[model samples]
Structures are given as C-alpha cells and as structure tokens.
Target: MDCGPGDEGDGSSPVTTPTRTSSTPGRPSPPAEPSTAGRSSAAGRPFIAGQSSTAGRPFTEGQSSTAGRPSAPARLLASPAGVHAHARIAARADPHGRTVLPVLDGEGPLALRRTRATGPAAHVTLVGAMSGPLGGDSLAIDADVGAGARLSVGSAAATIALPGQDGAAARYDVRLTVADGAELRWLPEQLISVRGSALRVTTRADVAEGGRLVLREEQVLGRTGEEPGLLHSRLTVRYAGRTLLDQELTCGPGAPAGWDGPAVLAGHRAVGQLVVVRPEFAYESPESAVLGESAALTPLAGPAALITALAPDALRLRHILDDALSRLM
Candidate 1:
C-alpha cells in the first residue's frame, strides 16, 4: 500500500489476508474484503515537516511550524519551563440524533478544528499549532461522546517528538469516554520519536455497555535512518466497568534488553495497535488469528477486538492496521 507522507492509507492489500487459527462457537462472520484499490507506493518519499522531527532543522533560530501554521510565541517555544497544553472535546446528540460539538477547547500547541463531515458524525481534526512534545513537555486531550452521539477525531499530520533543553521526558495523555449508545473513532497519525528525545504516552478509554469505539495508534521509533531516543507507551480500555485491554511497550536506548530482537520489534521501525469495541462483539467476537506476517488479531474478553502489527515503515504499518480494521468492522 502507498501511504505518502501526507496521506494515511485507508484501503487493503491481498497479501495481508489473515490466517485464521481458531473460532468461537457464537461469533459473527468476518468482514468482507474492501474493494477499494490499494494505495500507491510510498518508497523513497522525503519526510515533510509534520511527518518527521528534524525536517529543515539545524536547531537554529527562526524556524517555521509545519504546514505553514504560525509557530507558538517565542517565549513559550524557547522557554526552559517546557510546554503544558490541554485540549478537550465534548460531543452530544440533538433531538433528531445529529451529533454536535458543544465544547471544543484547545490550548498551547494543541489546536482543534471542526471540519465538514460526510455523515451525521461530527468530525474534528487536531492541528499542531507549534513544534512540540519536546522533552519536558506535558500534553493531554480529553474527549466525551454523549449517548447516541457519534464523533470521529483525526490529526492533520504526524506528531514528531524532539529533544528539549531540559533533558526530561515528554508526557502525553489521552482520555476518552463513550456513553451508552454512542460511537467514537479516534484515528490519529503516527508519532515519530527523534533521536535524543524521550517521550511517554498513555491512552485510556471508558466505554459504557452499549458504546462503540475504534482507536488506532502508530509509533515510529526513529526517522528514516536515525536511532531512536526513548519511548514508552501504555494503553488501557474498560467496557462496562470491566477491563478489556491493558498493555505497555518501551523501546530505544533505555528499554529492556532485546526490545529490538526477533521476539519484539524485530528491527521494525513502525509499530501500531488497533482496538474496536462494539456491543455485538459480546455475543460474537472474532477468533484468534494472524493477519499477514507481522500482525495479529484477537478477540478480547468483552465486545472488543485487538490488532497489533509492526512494519518497516509508517506506510506499511498503516496498511496492516487498516486491513485488520476492515476485517473486524
């Protein structure tokens, strides 16, 4: 599949046809193959500003923000205090069941923009108003979907984590809440960890019994040929007050031994995970199976499914995740 620096792939490739291992007694049929054409090849494409951290950089003064957006104030961008930013989104349903955003608040480097939607679901795009998540930075995003509402969240570009003057690790937190009868899709771009940077990210989802969710996360250990710095990530999800999935990953210089060995990343640069939660999954869940060579799909204890994959590059990683999502949904 072709995923240009600017395009995130949304189609499938036949090479990733899953190899099933087991099935449950009462499970729905797997999703049919998506008929969309495969994307073009992303090989040898140069990294743009948002797709990478070191774009056009010599760490000199007067550098511009990615995508022509205005950079943050000089004091904030260069301050030794680091950045503290938060963005919040609250979506509710109208009497006629149309989704609406009553609260869209963004601060510091995290900017939220409402975009035109193709359906009833309210869509939001996260814009990186400034270069960030540098070491010592603290950022968080909170989203709430009320009952019967549908919301889809995406980012304008990939996030690049860079080194900071303080030598402290950057922190990012995501909190998502899905009310009963509501649906949410959190599909952001990849996060690239640059050399000399340290970053830690956590994502938690609280889903009501009848709520539905589809979340995707992708991490690129380092830009093209560079060595990664330090990265740690954790994900937790609860459905109806019960744990559905909880996992953690660490990589780079300070990670546990052999993290890049065969059993783990196996030298892959891009790693990703996808989770889908639906009430119907309680009655019918996908069977444990291997999708392609680098990805796996398994049914969770509740009405959820998980997909984990690794790839040589962000393009391929998104292909594997997108294929798994198509199969699950």
Candidate 2:
C-alpha cells in the first residue's frame, strides 16, 4: 500500500491498483514495494508513532527524553582555585527579602564590591561586571592570588533574613596559597544566619615561609527580631602543617548549658574570631582589649593570635573587629 504525508491508517482512503510490468511471459508480476521514508509509510510508522519496531518488544526512551523530568540531585564540585577575581557564586530567597552573595572578590584594589538589595526575597544574580554589584544566582568569589600578589575582601551591607519555619543554609570552602614574602588580607562582611537557620564555612590557607596571612570572620544571628541565638558556626584555621585554631559555636537548643561559665561564652550573645599568622608578628596579651574596652581575649600557646568577643549582638562584634582591622591595615 502507498501512504502519503499526514495520513493515518484509518482505512478511509480508497484503494489504488498497482501498475504491473511483465519481466517474462510466463512469470507473474511481483508485488510492488512500499516506500519506507515517510511517517505514513508502514516502515516509518513504528518509529514515528512511538511503537516497537520488533514484534512484542517494548520501546524505551533514553536520556534524551528522560532529561526533561526532574530527578534526584547530582553531586557538584566547585574549585575556588579555578575562579578569577570579582566572580559571583550563588543567590537565593531569604526571609528578609534581600539577596545573598556567598562569595565575591578579586586580586587588586577595589578587589571586592559590596551592595545591598531592596526587597525581601529579591532575585540575586552574579555576572562578571567591572563596577556595581557582582550578581549571581548562587555564590561569588575570587580564589586565586598570584605569587606576591595582595588582595582585600569585603562586603557592603549586613546580610539579613526574615523569620521562617524552614531553615536556610550556606557553605563556603576557600583555599588560599601565599608564596614567600607575599601578604593577603581577607576581610569579608559578617555572615548573618537568622534564627532557625544554619550555616557552615571551612577555610584553608597554605602559606610558605616568610608569607603573611591576615584573616577575620564575623557572624550575627537573629538580626530582625529577638531570638535565643542568631547563628551556629564551626571554624578551623591551620598554618604550615600546624593547627592554629579549631572552634565551634552552637546556640539555642543544643547550646552548652554551662556556656555562662567563665571558660565559655560568659553569657554574651555575639562572637567574633580573628587570626593573624606571620613569621615575626607581635600581638599584645589577652589582657590587652581588642576594642580598648574590657573585652575578652584568649591567646593560643604558639605563634598565632586568637581573640573571642561576646558583644551585645553580632553587629556589635562585627564593628568592633572592623575598627580593629582598619588600624591593622
């Protein structure tokens, strides 16, 4: 049977007789063959109509079709070493209606840009821009600092979040390598993990002999409203194969019942940590207050400086260190 385009086998068309040519006087003419190229043709019908070509065999759609469906999430790998300066990482919805830029910075003066969003849950995007906010749907950052290169990291506004039942989370892993005689100053804005939210950050720095690393991390919790605590954070710092600092803070339900003890938080709400490692660096004793006030300072037994603060709030702790950092610079 001859089939044309746009025709289905409903048996509505009239049958047409086939023309016959005799090859030999005694042999009957062979049946005419059907065209196999068109969808209406029998040979192409099975494939185009989504039917099995082989009898009793089922047809299976592979990745090309299944790709449209949302499946389980796949694991993804991110390397800060591969990113250039002034790059965006990720952005997401927040209770406060503001955008969150996880990581953003570069390797020169004005190496980092800071900005704030207007509304609650605003869409944040990161693009490679020369000026203005570096936008991204997720995180943003610069992972590379050439040998002997200098860079400074900072954020523009206090990241805020609204109250919500379901918690939010973010993770940052930064690896910095400073060659001999090089210096790196990393001063990122405070991270605000509002009540009921959780955040985890890990930073590793590899510095050669004679290299200098100045680093600071500030976190605030429950900025918008009153809550037991604003953040639960864990931080680890290492230098030249020696562990410089290992600290963890868990507020609220699982917080240490004796956190008010002299050895613990001493009933303070906000906390900050700063570590500076250099071959020949000098820091006053824990008795020397960081903010000229009667603040608490804990000095490790080795060549690193570790200071902890219990401020009225996370914001206070952030500013205390910000002022201290300006002096160090």
Q: In candidate 1, what residue range of length 10 has the lowest lDDT sum?
A: 17-26
lDDT of 2 by residue, 246-286 (tens): 77776644466765456666656566777776666434433
For candidate 1, write residues 1-329 as lDDT tens digits. Answer: 01212122113221221111121112122222223122211231111112212221211111111223433333345544566666778888878778777676655556565654677788776755455577788999999999999999987668888887658999999999999999999999999999998999999999999999999999998899999989999999999999999999999998999999998999999999999999998788889999888889999989999999999999999999988888887
Candidate 1 C-alpha error for residue 129, in Å? 0.8
* Cα RMSD (angstroms) for every candidate in the order listed: 14.1, 24.6
The alpha-carbon deviation from the true structure for residue 81 of candidate 2, after best TM-score superposition, in angstroms, is 26
- Backbone clashes in model 2: 22
Per-model CA lDDT versus the true structure: 0.73, 0.40
What TM-score fits each model?
0.77, 0.51
